[model samples]
Target chain A: MTLSIVKNATCTFCGCVCDDIELHAEGEKIVKTKGACSLGESWFKHHTAERLYPDALIDGKPATVDHAVEAAANYLYDANMPLVYGLSNITCEAQREAVFLAEIIGGVIDSHTSL
Target chain B: MIYWGGNPAECHPRHFTKYSLTQKGKFIPNGRKDRTMVLVDIRETPSAKAADLFLQIRPGKDFEVITALRAIIKDQPVNPKSVAETGLTVEQLQDLVKQMKAARFGIIFFGMGLSMTRGKHMNSAGVLMLAAEMNAFTKFVAMPMRGHGNVTGSDMVMRWSTGYPFGVNLCRGYPRFNPGEYSTVDLLVRGDNDAALILGADPGATMPQPGIDHLARIPTIVLDPKVTHTSRISRVHITTAATGVSAPGTVYRMDEIPLPLRPALKSPYPTDEEVIRRIREAVAKKPAWRPSPNGQMAIV
Candidate 1:
């Protein structure tokens, strides 16, 4: 087994933003987390491929990426009162894109900021 | 001076310890001992352990309790037994107020415990007013202990772009703000939205049961790296890179200070910005298009 520790990493699990985390990675996966709370440790350790849903589905059926995008766009376009929510966990760049979508569709936009 | 609602020890351990409690302020020469802290909450929290005085009040009595404390601080007589609704007598509250007046510099940090309870807005305002009133005899400031790393960032972005922080309606081609009417929870609960685009939060796990039920019936689109309760029931789930991890991007600190991120891993899926931009492009056409009967789905 190979072993390596990445230092000065930030734990994204909580608002603490504890920047002193060290991730113990074997190969490409984080196996353990140091300097993290229990919540952050679990977030990094268990967030592996087995826990992720990677397929794009439309109407509960698997669809191509392009089809998914078009379906999403169509959903927003046809919506009389569209709700664009959740931008806190993404990047500023992504948030800007979401804002662009909200403006184009003339929808109401909010995030967990108010939740 | 006071922690109105939040339990900083559990929610914001680092921030509370580093900046509010243990850290030394300019006027308060001692790092931790110089400041006399007061805690007011519905129950005992770990933060209460740090308080010089703990005022535990019944839920929804925050406004009444704070006002009574303010009255006593100003030497205004309040009915002793009536003010005792907070489980603290007027004399005990007056003692805390005396300490507040003695402090060289004081600050109150609150959280959702106050904002979500009854008299929500007024509860926050009352604490702010108390802090301001304390200024008559000493220096005091009030601040909220905001949750989530970038909740403050989300508000700042919306304020800069749309001139509103949250619950903004753009149906008129311009931004309009109405908190209760346009907010996400209200829209979901009222079944007002036809479609929802969830960017990174797990509202399904956090929203009220009614809101969650309505969301399940809607055409929901989710963009997230992890499979959350929101994405589990969403009509479409796109795996996007985590902003501060696999995708290098900028995130504002809880305090609204911007911090640049450095990616620790090569992202397998596209970044959220790229995915959102593609969706925006697809929505830009004036007339919507549909594929032919025989047409097949293609890659984005």
Candidate 2:
């Protein structure tokens, strides 16, 4: 059995936003949690990925990260009327960037939570 | 207000430990013992377990409950059983109503379970009304337990940046808002979008069945640090550093105070801010990249 401990991490998953969380990371994978609520524990323990890739499919075909970025950029840039949504879930810095992106595209910007 | 909508115990585990009756808020120094905690819900919850009194109401009976409470506060004869299908007896409800009237300083907090359920914004409206009514009786306030740390901040920043709040249109070189017309659920459910950029949230897990089905048909981009229902299906699933924990930023507490986010861990992905910056750089060359009246982004 392996054991570890750490603290003072915020849980980004919910509104409570518990800022004190402790996790037992067994070499990159979290196995246990201390000082965290059940929800926070579940969030840290499960915040792992099963795959690692920089490239993805845009419309059912494999594309490079640059290609996808360019494509998404073009979609916003070329549109006469566009809406950029989804901000509440990310950090404020990301939200600021999104606002900048929306401005350049002359598009609408919104967070999904406003609904 | 009532816990009629959400079960905070299962969702927000530390609410009681940090802010509710069990916790000693700055005002209520005596904590649970000093405060009269009244719960109105459809079922028993962990938070209710510690309440001084509990009133189990029907699924969609919040409106009725509020009306009765208002009547009681006004010194009118309100029969509790006549108000709704709630399981609480008249005497139990009247006692709770009296406590609410007598509270020196009280806060009514609710969750998404209220907004998404039968009453929708009306439920919030009613709760807000209760707060107003209670003001005449005692010091009382109602606040929504906004789900994300900065979810409320998102709206605040958007509102401050643009004249309108959420669901605003910038295509006309100005901001315009129409709730259902530009809401996320409506946008997805109506299939009005050709592509989507999912950030921070997993619409697949949070959206209703119809909205989820519609999102599945579009070209979607996801920015998340972990695997989620939306990220798994997105065309470009770009991972990012967790905002509050891995990247320092700012957020608004439920009380509308802007709190600085503290980072506690290192991350491999770019901050949501960085990704947005990159995307903004890629799109800035467009023809209509004009700043708004507030010097923010405006439709050109």
Q: Which ten residues in a row have the lowest lDDT in candidate 2 chain A?
A: A48-57
Q: Candidate 2 on B1-300: residue-level lDDT in tens? A: 345466677777777777664777677677767777666677777868767677777777777777777777787887654764655456766777777777787778877656666766677778889888889878888878777667777777777778665777765566778776777787778877666677777888988788788767766677677656886666566667766556678776656666666554456656778766776777766555565567454444
RMSD per candidate (Å) reads: 5.7, 4.3
Instruction: Return model 1's CA RMSD, one decimal.
Output: 5.7
The digit string of per-residue lDDT tens for model 1 on B1-300 reads 688888878777666565677887677678778867778899998888888788888888888888897898889989887887767788788788777788877788778898788876677778889888988998888877767656666787888999998888887667999877898988999999888999988888999999999889998998888767987778887777776667767777665667766455556777888888999998886563332345431112
lDDT at B205 for candidate 1? 93
**What DockQ score does model 1 reach against the true complex?**
0.51
Displacement of residue B166 (Cα, Å) in model 1 is 1.3
Show pairs that collide, candidate 1.
Answer: A66-B300
Candidate 1 chain B has its poorest 10 consecutive residues by lDDT at: B291-300
Off by over 4 Å in 2: A1-7, A22-33, A48-57, A60-62, A79-81, A103-108, B1-4, B25-27, B75-82, B85-93, B163-165, B260-265, B289-300
Model 1, TM vs. native: 0.87
Q: What local lDDT does model 2 show for residue B27?
A: 73
Report the Cα lDDT for candidate 1: 0.77
- Best candidate (score: DockQ): 1
Local distance difference test scores for all models? 0.77, 0.68
List chain A TM-scores, every candidate, in order.
0.85, 0.83
Q: Cα deviation in Å at residue B294, candidate 1?
A: 40
